[model samples]
Target: MSLGGKVWITWTRKTKSNYVGKIILAAALTALCILMLKQSPSFNSRSPFSNHEPGVTHVLVTGGAGYIGSHAALRLLKDSHRVTVVDNLSRGNMGAVKVLQELFPEPGRLQFIYADLGNAKAVNKIFAENAFDAVMHFAAVAYVGESTLDPLKYYHNITSNTLVVLEAMAAHGVKTLIYSSTCATYGEPEKMPITEETPQLPINPYGKAKKMAEDIILDFHKNSNMAIMILRLFHPHVSFFHYFSLSVKTQMARLGEAPRPELREHGRISGACFDAARGIIPGLKVRGVDYKTPDGTCIRDYIDVTDLVDAHVKALEKAMPGKVGIYNVGTGRDQSRSLLRHVRRLTGVNIKVDFLPRRPGDYAEVFSDPSKILLELNWTAQYTDLQKSLGIAWRWQKLHRNGYGTSVTIADS
Candidate 1:
């Protein structure tokens, strides 16, 4: 063979060898990515509709028809996020869901699914069907008295169901979670303003169940990339406001707190006071008048529903993978005798009062020191005035004399 021909053959062979090496490297890289994606929890959980508008988040709100959950759903919708609310209507109200549906009539804006979290099959199915970016676990049997009476119900609803939810999230790859815990987990603390560091020696089954749920989430978070936030909320006062946009109090009343009559006994102090003022009941029965407090009544930190929802949204925004955040959400002020005084002055009704023995699991005083939330999430209670907040709620109550019933009458009080 000629010298030049041999050189050309050598160059052609080298070129072919280099091309084959490049193709092999590409194939290996692709296979490695496939394996990583299969093992990655975050990648598996990412929503299929991730190409939606910028800054838009798809959130699944469990128990979104309930008081705090409804308010949180509203806030999320107002901020232009897609929301899916799942509730069995056991303790939640359908009327609240109807109101939200009416407000956000646009499709893909709000969705309500009637499913009990206890049904693990149904919960897993729901997670499989929807591409959820985050989950707000707010569906739980929250009444302390009711929890004591039926501890199984609390365990099944709060603790066991929470395990179901975490399992589904792990299976589906949903990573972000905002848990609605209660300060009841604190029980009767030895200090006045309870901090996040306060020992969780729960006095009631409700609190104990919630603490168990917290433990489950914390355990799951350790070995996962899930961003978990546990907000230990205090007593929520019924009031209305649009944190993102300014709405009139009356307009705000369209979405005010309206617990069902059967559940009202387990509801907030403001709701019971409003009921008495509206003549639904003969009088307001004050439970526990022999506590260590100044007024011999159980004192609790009352957070406005708006502020509580704000903290949840902030926590969602601040959630980081592999990080767990726990905060006591409250106004840091105690409401005891003053809450009743405010209710009377706002309703213009001299509500009859009956002093009864302290309800079981009653605490002398339980308020929160929300400095951690303020510093970390930059959240603070804007509706600090007790009377103003009560007055806004009272107007709504006066309008809906039957608590979300169609029989609306202007109270004569």
Candidate 2:
């Protein structure tokens, strides 16, 4: 699943003969996109944090066993917040949850509940059982191509399930919500530097369902004082492992983005690359190669998992009542060819590449201007260098060749 924030598409330039017409058409499209964006009401409330004691806050993390959610849970636990993770384990790996438990080991520091978000009764039951201060909603099926193949699954899982969670939040008086959104919501916007106000013209069912969920939240926000922060993230690359458990007084690979084998086909490209290197798969398949980008391959803004978790923590801290903020999270943009080169170099494998035609629901170039998240959330991606980011993930891959199948060992920081 290509998890990301809001993205912008770089329009290809036409020949000199049609340059004037192209400019006029581009202006019209831009105006239309902005007009469409205005359909949703704006949120001007800021710094809405209420007066509270500086102590542990109970947080309910939906899909906490998944990639980004697991990382966010680790961060929250490290910050001394009581966390309750609810995941059905359909797409989430229990190993990630076990890792969190092993790292914390405290009774109340972490709890895992096997429940699906689609079951409203179970969702309400979970909320009734726990007293949650905030909710990190990260449970969703996020494969762009798969969403195209199974539109109903995307709607039911991403759209309807989000509604169920929001309803439960409203019923339980859980005010603060940190929503994990993707850049795919922007689709092929005819604009550069996508902002919160950019038109959300999603092209695929995954993006459409997510956009619908955002709309529902906005509608609810209009009537109530629910503090909401929707983070539209760009492509999150590489598995982030390596953390120091202060309680243990040592550093270890306690938590990381370890997707299960079944989901790898629909998971991050980095996982597939590592699998190919480890001889688990044949070779890397370059999906699209005729894109309009410099390398004729799609370009995306890849955010490191560590940096992605940091953005969520900052948003959770800044969430306040009656205020809503939407920000784009990304580091910078890199083409597919460049990423493959890095994987090959870092893994020291001559990864075979099979150039294929364009993939469905895929855009040519997708990146974002993360200035809003930087200014509002005070968050900026630290792992900006692709080589450095991939290098870190590759090291983790080397250690966990079977991905949580082997016993984790303690290592010096």
Candidate 3:
């Protein structure tokens, strides 16, 4: 063969090899870009569960086994959303989750995990495993007196743990968050019917910790495409009917039958009063009867638990990405004696009231001007009739003397 022929053949082979390498590199780069786009919250069009049909949002209910958290979970389940409840059971009750399981017997509709938000690894694992569309954060150490005594626990559980949840959400592209905040963030308001514009001058560690969590959530929203809803709930009472129904349903559930239809309204104080009437507790200790109010007792705005839970559902559905919504959840009425009198009427017992000195950090008057939630979310307190609300509570307490069919004493207030 000729030398020119050999050189031409070798050059052709080298050029073809280089061309193949370039094509492979280009393909790799394109695949990398597509993967990045799929993971990015701004670019991603569908949830992690792309196979699922549209409009079926999967929600993570943190502290789902607690009082308010359980109620939120139940509502979410009823709304046909897949709910995953995470709780450490530190303050939450598994019995509540059991009741919820009885209430929502449908498989795959509700899930419960014995986990804590403070554990970043556990939180991240849950987020990684599930495609959550939003998060309703209700887990926190919220006892006012306990918070004052153990401020560190409050700070860790409320503030630090919230940061962990936010971090996980940001990393995993979960953009919507409905935080269970409190009117305690307002402290002792200067006037009546505290508006959303009311200054947040928290007087206790519990409120301070929650306010800190809110600040962090806002900061996260500022940096990400996060949609945040802060529902500052006033005193949300559970109705006797709620406890009665739950107790009855729980018993019926054991017999392989469906739970009863849910009734609106739930009570908080009526539980304690019923306990007193039934002689479970000696009597009700009226806290702070000299707070400079009309009845000399500290006044509070109490909304039914069902109403409060419904507000969360509305907030979850209406929350917009990159926008923040803050609303007060309450009935917009202040009552002290009226609440006690109604309790007496419901229980049909002369409830003995022991007037005690005001507890520390107790607010003088704190109700809500919930007009914003009403107008914006179209949410209203349906059970505004206090007597009817208490009556429902009385019946429940009378039936479930042990509370939720468990030996564990549920928090009455």
Candidate 4:
């Protein structure tokens, strides 16, 4: 997605040649976008050790096998909290689930259930079997384009199922809920950065469903007295891999005065990875430059997967007696879209650009205003640089190309 642009079409602007009107409209839009940024919610996390509560707490994280789910589960476990995971295994893999299990705090403290959230009986049964102090909901249908085409499925799975889960929560008296909201709800923001107070103008079914779920959850928060933290999750990112890579690349860039870009060996862009004895070779893409950003490429908010989950863990604890806190999760930074160009510039990988039109349902640019969370929760994004983050992602991608982290195997399927 393109990040920045000098020109924009405004609803207030008239097509006719009216220079004064155009200037006024431009100023209005610029002011509105700035307001969105200034009003954005903050996101930061305290160390797990300091954040833990008085007594032992048992937490239930639904959809604990998926990407963000797994990451959150690990964070909860890292803090020595008891955790129970429930996943239907539709889009979740057993391998990812198993890997996450190993990261648990203690033995028998972390458990997994293979069940759907829609089935209140099943959810109730799990709660009855184990005492849970809080519940983190991450299970839902997620896909902007897919949701648009087949809205019913999105509605049924995300909206209907979430309602059922809420009912179950009410029945079981589970008041603490941490919802995994999405940035899609912001939908082609009239402004650059989006805040919690920004009007939810979703243009797709998935965003609508997520927004509906948030509304329902907040309603419950009002009546049921649930302590909820609605986290508006941004792009996907892995912490360990990306942070490490950035350190290496940044060091190299400053060490040598190439004035241009250099090429790095082990850090070469993996155009595609093959799990051979040699190692992983990432597929390199040269396109994505001509965007509106500085390099004419896409810019994204790729929070380290670790930081993403850390925020969730902190968010769950931050909820209070009567109010619910909504926060955005992202680096609040931009990343270049041209993987090859970035690799070449940062790591020095030579690759060709292959231009392609933006995909349907693609957002031009999306980032977070995590200032609120920082002010409220005393949290800040640990991994601040993008190049370091990309290096981490590439490393994780390489190691896991053989289904290292999650179980996603493709053999001409």
Candidate 5:
């Protein structure tokens, strides 16, 4: 078989395993993701659509139905703003949206469409329907490891599709945009903390694709007076207990931490699955700035889900002037050396953390210098103090320890 054919076959097999195997993996992933969500403690729904602001009479949110997109959409609705959601429903789930129907504050104010941005006709139709004040483009394939193996998929989705969307937006005279960016764009950093001025050198196709899109948008901004805000997201975890009952907080009091906990004995984590609303334990390796920094370990910026979303909402306000705004979206806080100790204290699982050599394309420490965003957007991370933020994560992990999930079956067409 051809190389493409072989990979296609293997991917097909993995996705279409026996019914029972698919069931087990789906249940496991969902439950694990739910717990991960709680542990990370994310943000959603801050801006109401009817804030009655002079900015953005109508907002076009591509990929508005995904995790961050859904949260942004909910916030827009809360501010009483006119909103439209366009998604292909590939990686995005419609069920994730809240407040689309009830308490909308305005009937027919929020709109949703199942369409791909690559289809310029569909996108152009969307632009024609509304005189949008700004566009928040969040629709793109975002998986680190997967991008390594299949860069074409990432490029097509993020690069080609993004070009199509931007052209349509510009042609329709919609100039404002709030883009979702990542810290990985910094590649392996030379400094402990990365500032907005840090050079971007992405190691993965996903980051490269995002960086490519960033360049294209800026190019458009360079020629045109289209205002742009790029929010470079640092990893933010969301940890929450279901229904607010049997809360993760309660579980923490009941259980204590473990010296080392193994997520699965002799098992490994696949790259595509390394997202916030999923598994948490990655073995601690010591190399990066454990000496220069206070801790003998790497520190990363981890903002709350809510705080991250707040940056996006604020970006809309700054979208009209045609000047490009670049800001690091993170807690301005760093995860600590004592984090592993704290995890064990909370999970009561004896996880074995073997110290390995420094992994390539890995940085020692990189948090955000969020001073500009704080000064510019009048925004700062609301959840300060890393320990306090982590407290909620422990609660989510411990609460969902047993398991709870819905069934899903994956297959290749």
Candidate 6:
């Protein structure tokens, strides 16, 4: 063998080894790209439709012009879902709907219909016009005292209207329903931290009507292919725009407080407390200060409106065909007189209080045990700080002092 032949042979072997290394690296890169593409459609917290079937979901939010409903609609819009809001405007504000429209700004992403759920023909017509993937029913007369005074009205609005909605849903074959139930359906629970298993012995007509509606929905679910989620919500505090808008006079009248001429008709305890701190109202009127609690006042689990709506969104995603899911939405913490203290701290004002006797059908304490929802849906309350919640509520109430800018009216459309 010669020196030239040995050198040529060694160079050829080294060149081939380098070529094979480059090919292996190229193949590894290609495999990684393919794997990423395959896993790209997995679940996304920002957008619920990432893992779902293609095309935006159309959700019919009954009472979407109302407080909680409006917030839920806002969340749905944020997650790229098309929302159609149906409201009678009897207890809902059109200004809330207007706000939603302005926020989304995308044409056809949000819509509003002036229709009562009790009117089956109108509800059916709505379903016929649009293909709704789900229905979040929040339309109901929820005033506890008023329901007690006029039990028939509660039955008509809560019970009968629910039946009408269900009938329309069945006709349209809309299988998914997210019902807005209340913790009041459990009445005064014998145990602390009420769970879904608690007996539903509602003490008032309002609670009874909700319970009755729940029964009707469950029956319909059993007989049909409907997926039902009954959320027994606790006290949901104010949202960004302050959704719950009971008349200030009505609330004052219930508490035996003198109505002020300057005050707007719509406000809640959070708003009222904020107003009192700002000297808008005379002072905070504390109703039922003689309840059997540590502070001798009724205790409730106050969850932020945003948190409550988030749970609904999760439930919508998790709803399965021919299944019934019941979850309690609350902070699972008791808040009584400390709520007022928190409000005072948030407002940085010494809020005056006018204590009154306990109202009828008032429970001493009612909170929630939301472990099941936490474990099942991987959902938990984000705005759990009482001061922070009240601060947000106070800011919103201060800006929208008139409550939605105008009273709701029946739309011509």
Number of clashing residue pairs in every model? 1, 7, 10, 26, 45, 3
Comparing 3 with 4 on TM-score, the higher-scoring candidate is 3
Candidate 4 has its poorest 10 consecutive residues by lDDT at 253-262
Q: What are the per-residue Cα lDDT tens digits for candidate 1 across 1-50? A: 99999999999999999999999999999999999999999777644343
Decoy 6 TM-score against native: 0.78
**Candidate 2 structure quality by residue, lDDT tens digits, 8-61:** 112333355378888999999999988877764542322112212257688889
Model 2 regions more than 4 Å off: 1-54, 245-252, 408-413
Candidate 1 wrong stretches, greater than 4 Å: 1-54, 242-253, 407-413
Higher-scoring candidate on lDDT, 4 or 5:
5
TM-score, candidate number 1: 0.84
* CA error at residue 88 for candidate 4, angstroms: 1.1
Off by over 4 Å in 4: 1-54, 238-298, 338-340, 343-353, 405-413
TM-score ranking, high to low: 1, 2, 3, 6, 4, 5
lDDT of 6 by residue, 1-413 (tens): 89999999999989999999999999999999888877786422223211233587889899888878887888898788989899998777777787777767776688889998888888889887777889999998777766777899889999999999999889978889999999999999889899999999899999999999999998877788899998999987654423323444221111111113333223356667776887877898877867778778788888888888889999999999998999999888876557888888777899888987766666889999999999998888888877866765665455445555533232222
Q: Which stretches of candidate 6 lie over 4 Å from their true place?
A: 1-53, 241-267, 406-413
- Which candidate has the top score in lDDT? 1
- TM-score of every prediction relative to native: 0.84, 0.83, 0.80, 0.70, 0.67, 0.78
- How large is the C-alpha RMSD of every model relative to the true structure? 12.0, 26.2, 10.4, 28.4, 20.1, 18.1
Q: How far is candidate 1 from the true structure (C-alpha RMSD, Å)?
A: 12.0
Task: Tell me how far the alpha carbon of residue 133 in candidate 2 is from the true structure, in angstroms, after superposition.
Answer: 0.1
lDDT per residue as tens, model 3, 325-353: 99999988876458878877776789898
